[model samples]
Target: MLGAPLLEEASGIGALGIDLTSLLVYLINFTVLGLILYFMAYKRIIGMLDSRSERIRESLEEADRVRKESEEQQESMQKALDDGRQEGQRVLAEAREAAERYREQQAEQARAESEQIVSRAREEIKQERDAALESVRAEFAVLAVSAAEKIIKRSLDADAQQDLIDEVISESNAKQEQD
Candidate 1:
């Protein structure tokens, strides 16, 4: 029964103009061509593609590393700039403080010198006043002696005149002190 179905199938294919031996030869040729192409060209093309892919990956990684390093350098530069600004401010503050201290010292020295000058002037005035008072007292005593000699109308002994003048000067001094 299987032989009969095969014969019928073969006859059907023959009516359609199909030759089995030629079809087999064509299939064998196609398989051989495919295998040759895979060995000769396909593997080399795949290897080249793989190498290119690896190079692209490495380039990407290197670019990322360079970018990170650049960022770190920029941060360091910024930090240095900030520190410099702070140092400048600190120096300026110190200079201002020193100037203020110098001004205060100069003021204090000027005040001390002025006080000393004023004290000397007052002492000189007091000494001049005392000298003027002594001169007036001596002139008054001489005038009193001349008046007493005229009243008496006689030349008194030198000792009596001297004693009289001393007594008058002492009385005046005592009165002045009481007043």
Candidate 2:
């Protein structure tokens, strides 16, 4: 009687069209296929993704380094340009100083030359004045001798004449000194 209840339960499960052996076989096949695909394709796909990520990271680092180098180059170029401008200004200032010195020297030279010309002209005038004074003194002595001869109304010897001329000249020099 116990076996009869067991057979009845088995028939009832069969009536629902369920096969336990085929279900176990299909489960085993699906598990084996999933494991094979994981081993062969999944690992390679993950490795490819990791390698691509590493390449992208390296490219970004290279771009950052290049940007830093370009910034450094630009700073150096600006410094060089500033230095060039300073050097040009210094050279221009030196040139201006040199020109000013040249102008001063030329002016001083002209002044010295003019002074020399003026000094020469003054010396010439003094020499001419002395010569004219000497000529006037000689003519005055001759006129005095002639006037004396007319006042005496007589001819004198050469010694007397010379003595008289010497006296008259001394008297004239005394009068000029008193005046």
Candidate 3:
């Protein structure tokens, strides 16, 4: 019995099928409140948040780009360093080989020069020996003729000189055979 008026009011509204004017007024109120909130609060707050988010996103993208570029640069520099080291090693090896070859060539040249010097010395000794032997032979001929004239106490005839030379040659040959 106490809920009769409230129930009747609810039933009366249901029977009338809803108040168009009140509905219109409520919609107008809600729309105005939404507009005010959007203009006064939501728009500003959301705009600040959006701008901050955009700045952060741009900064992150920039950081990523810089990081990628830096990594690429570092890799390139490392490759260059490796290449430089390889080139240096190759040059050093080539230089060492060249130096070794040069040293060997010099040693061979020195050896050839020594051989030439020894051969020239031997030839000089042979030439000197031949000259001395010729000089001695001439002296021996003169001495033998002078001694034959003194021993005989007079000049020898050609026939006598020939006989004397034959005897001297026979004596020299016998002495050489004995020695």
Candidate 4:
């Protein structure tokens, strides 16, 4: 009797295009394969994936740090360049000022030298004028004495003539001094 009912159930499942025992076997086989895969490969694959993800995150963090450091370095280099330019400008300005001062000093020195040269020239001209005047006075005195002697047609003794000439020169010098 139990066999008859089981055969009927099998026939019913066959009519539905299924065998219950084969379905049970397939379900058991699928469970075992799933367990095997989970124990043998799934955990390891997941672990590998987790490790890869961690490494990727670490790499991203490192790259970010490097980028930040590069930016800071670039900023520092720019600041240094600016400071160098400012210093160059300052040095150039100082050099220009120094050059201007040097030019002014040279000009002043030249002016002073020119003034000294001019003053020396004036002094020399004055001395030459005095010497020429003295020469002319001496010559004129000698000529006057000679002309008087010739006009009078009288000759004094040499000592007397010399004394008269001396007196005449002294009187002329006195007049010049008074003038």
Cα lDDT tens digits for candidate 1, 56-112: 999999999999999999998999999998999999999999989999999999899
Ranking by lDDT: 4, 3, 1, 2
TM-score of 4: 0.67
Instruction: Go through the candidates in order and give the clash count of each.
Output: 0, 0, 0, 0
Off by over 4 Å in 2: 1-40, 117-179
TM-score of decoy 2:
0.51
lDDT of 2 by residue, 1-179 (tens): 33343223555556454667778888999999889988888888888899999999999999999999999989999999999999999999999999899999989998998888888888888888767755666677778777777887877888887887778768776886799
RMSD of each: 7.5, 8.2, 6.9, 5.5
Q: Of the candidates shown, which would achieve the greatest TM-score relative to the real structure?
A: 4
How many collisions between residues are there in candidate 3? Answer: 0
Of 2 and 3, which scores higher on TM-score?
A: 3
After superposition, candidate 3 runs with Cα above 4 Å error? 1-45, 152-179
Give per-residue CA lDDT, model 3, range 1-179, as digits (tens): 45344224555447554767878999999999999999999999999999999999999999999999999999999999999999999999999999999999999999999999999999999999778755665566568878867777899888987777767756765775698
- Model 4 residue 13 CA deviation (Å) reads 9.3
> Candidate 2, after superposition: displacement of residue 44 in Å?
3.6
Off by over 4 Å in 1: 1-77, 150-156, 175-179
TM-score preference between candidates 1 and 4, better one: 4
